[model samples]
Target: MSFVAPWFLVALLLVPAAAAVYVWWERRRTRGAEPWATAPLMPSVTRGGSRRHRHVAPAIYLLAAAVLIVALARPQHDVTKKIEQATVMLVTDRSGSMRSADLKPNRMEAVKAAASSFLDQVPAQIRVGALAFNQKTKLLASPTTDRARVKNALNTLTGAGSTATGDALAAALAIVRPQGAAGVQTPAAVVLLSDGANVRGRDPIALARRAGRLKVPVYTIALGTDEGTLTSKRANGTTKTERVPPDREAMRQIADASGGTTSDAPTTEALQAVYKRLGSAVAEQPGKDQLTSLPVGIALVLLVVGAGVSLRLTGRIV
Candidate 1:
């Protein structure tokens, strides 16, 4: 129940005004009808031949007028347009540490769920790509408008190796970074979903600077509680979620250097909110209404013609 031309609502005032004038005319036409002394015996003729139409015709005409007003106001249904879509890439860590159950069923599951939801919300217009990283980074999907495919890629992520945030980010850029020669300016971005644990390659800060030079913004979506814990299981099938430590400070440095933003969520809803913001930032253009719907305009015209015909038939006997 949304309106494209909300300003059309102001036209409703004419309907009530027309009704009031019609009612007043009817009263004036009927007033003093029996002033004559022989009025009781004098023959009288009602305006309507069919008793049901005494009020129906006027009501029908009013409805027709209302329909015409709305049609002229240019009513539009579900319509959209995509002029420009921001280039968005995702970099996710799938290391063993990502399996910590600090966020929910597990951090890995949360990441998958979040990625899936974000893909679903991406309006089918933006070009989005996804990648996962452990000891090495893999491009799960390339920049595409096919959101379902991207979500399918997210579902394939598994946590069993060490994290390489820097490498993963570099690989994601390789897949998403556009060739700046189409006479087009496409701002690129990467959403880094990680536990802030980096254990491979050169300093993450240096990589962040490189990202800046490449004109790629990196938004960090951190998934962990301030007092979250990590767990390790042995061959005996024993496990525990121990409060090893938190490493937000390291993640912050990467996010800040890339001239990007970071968001922390403790609940699913908060995580969802973070994803929505990131998704919006990545999606540059959405859909819109190009013109008023033809079917509605035709229907209104038919109603007006029907009303005019009714009035003509009523005038034939006069």
Candidate 2:
């Protein structure tokens, strides 16, 4: 919650001041009546209500005053709203390094699970696209509301060639970018997952800069631990084991350039968590909602109830 007119909040002191004044008046009246009547007879003279019941109406009025002061401050809070016609591109790396067994059965398999979770978390109104990249980028499915098609495309991905992070991001931008600027109001975003540095195709940082220019944010996830390794067989017989750690710095740079977030998922659980957050982020945006009327309504109701109680108990409304 936030306040637009914070200065008005100082007026809240008036509530406590009013309470003190009411307390002083009640004590002074009681003392002044002591000369005319004894304490026992004072209750009979007051008649309609007990001392406790008499305070109820004043207490309610004080509450109303406090709430009304809050209303004057102009409070606001964050509210989530679904983005209509929003397009999100899910780009996953199918590079040989993704075949590493650091994350359970394999990195690629875990990525598939996380991507499926992302699809499930995203709202049905959002259009999602699937893209897999290795030595080149492949658009398995264009942006569509059909989750089955995108999931099927994700399932087809397998660890293969070199990483082409830049090219994959570029391909996504081409699909989500507005045609002739007429559809510019439609929101578009890209989520790129990779386990290694760019080894082929275009420069990813450059493409991320282009995405920034197009007002499309590109979220980058660097998956895989420092100890991650990939084993490949040589033509002659023996296998060559090579360390293929995720390029976290590169991912961070890409996200920063595109005005998006960067996440390092060294394990499958962390990757899934990252995707879950991204799913909500891409589907809905936070909007500021003014809550001034809420307190104002509450205050009005409190005042009306307070007035009615005072009139019924004391034959006068304060």
Candidate 3:
């Protein structure tokens, strides 16, 4: 156990001195005692409940002193191994159809929540950027390690326009390709969250094919349950959910063509699974070395032992 401030150890020298003073005082008190036929009974009388409580006092003092000394040395702990730096980019759909409430609240809201969690779990070394798209895709932030900016960009998005899978994919890859160092990992990836509705530009399948050639894996998150539902607000107030078209399988195919697997999770939980899988499948880079857990653990042991000793001296066995 390394000390944050080693000077605190000087306090321990007081323990032996305090013990000597206690022994000296005990011997001086006994020197004046009178001899008696019931001399052995004296110990029993002194050992009654009240006397027992006093027996714990010395231990308590020792324990308190120990705690104070340990507290003087600060401690900290970390168990998880550190990860290396990496870059990740995401392309998400904000098409008009994403406004559907099939995924609860709406598809886009669910996507936003899932994206935020994924971003939060990513190691600090990983640079992440995001793209939000409808008719035309827009780069909300360049690939950056400043996570707050990426998440802020995600939260500000609102759904509108028609779905354009091709333009969005091409544009997102454009953002990822140049950011990578020569011979270093593409470091960039594309996670497309949509219902597989490709209406605005080129064919989505063709884009997926292009991604496969570019070594970019396009992971797809298919949103909605069987017999999908949609909610739209009318001019006269009030809202309602009605059965809408379902297109889960098409999204899955997009994933397959792009060398990425697809899974169905109609709720926010699905998005979580998707993001977790992405993290697990991807590899991290390299960086700085630091310590963890060892120092904190030693301090904890000392604290527990001192506390136990103090409690035992208080008349109850620890």
Candidate numbers sorted by lDDT from highest down: 2, 1, 3
Q: How many residue pairs clash in each candidate?
A: 5, 0, 2
Candidate 1 matches the true fold with a TM-score of 0.58
Winning model by lDDT: 2
User: What does the lDDT come to for candidate 3?
Assistant: 0.68
Q: Give the clashing residue pairs of candidate 2, or none.
A: none
Best by TM-score: 2
- lDDT by candidate, in order shown: 0.72, 0.91, 0.68
Question: Which digits, one per residue and each the tens of the lDDT, describe model 1 over residues 172-259?
Answer: 6666554532445566788988775788965677877777777677888767776667778878999866662436677788889987
Q: Who is ahead in TM-score, 2 or 3? A: 2
Model 3 ranges off by over 4 Å: 1-85, 179-185, 233-246, 284-318
RMSD to true structure for each model, in Å? 10.4, 6.2, 14.7
Q: Residues 1-318, candidate 3, lDDT per residue (tens digit)? A: 355666877887887788678667655544434353256665543323343454455654565566566666543333344346555777887766677777777777888888888887777777788888889889999989898899899998887777888888888777776543345554446777776477768777887877776667777777766666666777889887766443667677778787776777677677787777776544442223323344345556655665565455444433
